[model samples]
Target: MENLNIDLLKKIVSTYSPAGNETRICQLIKKEVEPYADEIYTDALGNLIVRKKGTGKKVLLAGHMDQIALMVTYVDDKGFLRFTNIGGISPAVTYSQRVIFENGTIGVIGCEKIDSLKDLTLDKLFIDIGATSKEEAEERVSIGDVCVYYSEVIVDDRHMIAPALDDRIGCYIMIEILKTMKSSKNDIYFVFTVQEEVGTRGAKTAGYAIEPDVAISFDVTATGDTPKARPMAVQLGHGPAVKVKDNSILCHPKVKNLMIDNAKKHSIPYQLEVLEFGGTDSGAIHLTRSGVPSGVLSIPTRYIHSTCEMVSLSDVKQTINLSIKILEEEI
Candidate 1:
């Protein structure tokens, strides 16, 4: 198996490309994939589409670039920023965390006095940027400005823990695949999508435009390996999970079987994933024009949506190997 590019993964995950604000991350990805792509362009919705032309089939691979964030709604008189959730943010996991705005303004999340932990909510939270008053806060941040969880990527001998790994790790996988894939007969479209954290918006648009014969999405899935966690079959360090079903879409049998067969043929480690909740870009891509067949490859992730989501290095490598096998062969 090929080695996982830890540096590349760290670089991509570190960028603050929250939903509706993907230009910076898109540019970074566009640069990384340009050399390997036959043609590259950005769609109206800011989805970075890189094509490797072929005549066998039009295959679309989507991995969203956007991460969950907080959008400022009001600035209090005392210079604290009140915000609303941009995606599926848990107040329990968000409190006392730090956030960084696009312009480099850093702030700490604070909450009002509450009687109990159950009473904690986003409404009670505020961001302190060290501003003395509303006017001062407005100078650095404005209504509608978004901020992402501020955290650093931590790499161990066998695992990676970082912020925004939900889909950024997916983006990193796609980028690596584009760079290392030797050749293919399918006209492949590698899309670094935006706003997936919100509603799979970018994939929906990109799918319509490409209208590929087959589609696959890369994203993270929750695990049951942690202490007394949900009873999920997936675990880190085992392998990639081939999607069977999720809340948003059912995996097409052909695509799902194709992944399983490829993994078996190549002796690649893999697991079956049936997420009881949550979804991926495949949810939107499969619903495209004429209803394209689609499936997903999920990395077993622990503590998803938290500041330090974790994935195994071995699992990442196996995912890349299986993905390459799927793309290099017939659809």
Candidate 2:
């Protein structure tokens, strides 16, 4: 955990990049890896692909740069901004949280303070940005501006908690791994894809363009170890979770086994991830061009799709180690 760059990770998770609007977070990622990459560019859909070439096999490693957020859909006569969830969001977790706009405007989100707890819905939520009238709110923010729940990265004991760590932690892993690897036999393509929170969209295009011999994606998977959870096997502080199955795709067995073998060989702890509800960038990568062999290395995350997602720093460090070990191999 000490080896990981907390500063960079914090900056990334803090940036507001809802599904279709991922420019700011993408820019933050580009700045971190631009010098290490041989080629860095954005695709038609604004996915940032950073290529670091080698000679053996083409390997594409993708982590999406977007986070779950809300979009300013309408404004009330009283200047309150009405928003729609931009991605799969938990209404229970988002209530009464502060959110920030792209233009540096700040607001507080409230879901109609109620006496009883079970009566809230997205329809009840509204953002108050301190505007006096509808025209005043419109002047500060437009109809399309996106807002991310405001949160700061905090390191407690051995875990890091912040908003958007689901994939930003994955994004951090990709960025750091590329910088750490000096040489390799594979032509490594590190792509910071967009719109993963909405659907595996950006990686679908970037994966097609690269058409690599192998694909590995870094993202987060839900853990059922939390209290009242619906029974999952993964736990925090365990090493990186290797995706075996999820709602979207059955991971390539060879790739998954290779990752597990590498982790054991290097004494890195890992857990088998079976997410009944979500997917990752590998979902798209596995579907590219006549089918590429792909797998995902995931972090066991808690309170996912919320403003304060938590992941073990130890798991994150192990993920970095396991990925680099895989990249250094011939297969």
Best by TM-score: 1
TM-score of 2: 0.96
User: Any idea how many clashes model 2 has?
Assistant: 1
Q: Please, what are the lDDT tens digits per residue for candidate 2 over residues 233-313? A: 899998898999998789999999999999999999999988887788888889888999999999888888887789998
User: How many angstroms is residue 63 displaced in model 2 relative to the true structure, after the best TM-score fit?
Assistant: 0.5
- Stretch of 10 with least lDDT, candidate 1: 1-10
Quality of model 2 by C-alpha lDDT: 0.87
Q: Model 2 misses residue 21 by how many Å?
A: 1.9
C-alpha RMSD of each candidate structure in angstroms = 0.8, 1.6
Local lDDT at 111 for model 1: 93
Off by over 4 Å in 2: 113-116
Per-residue CA lDDT of candidate 1, range 17-90, in tens? Answer: 89999988998888888889899999999999999999899999999999999999999899999999988999
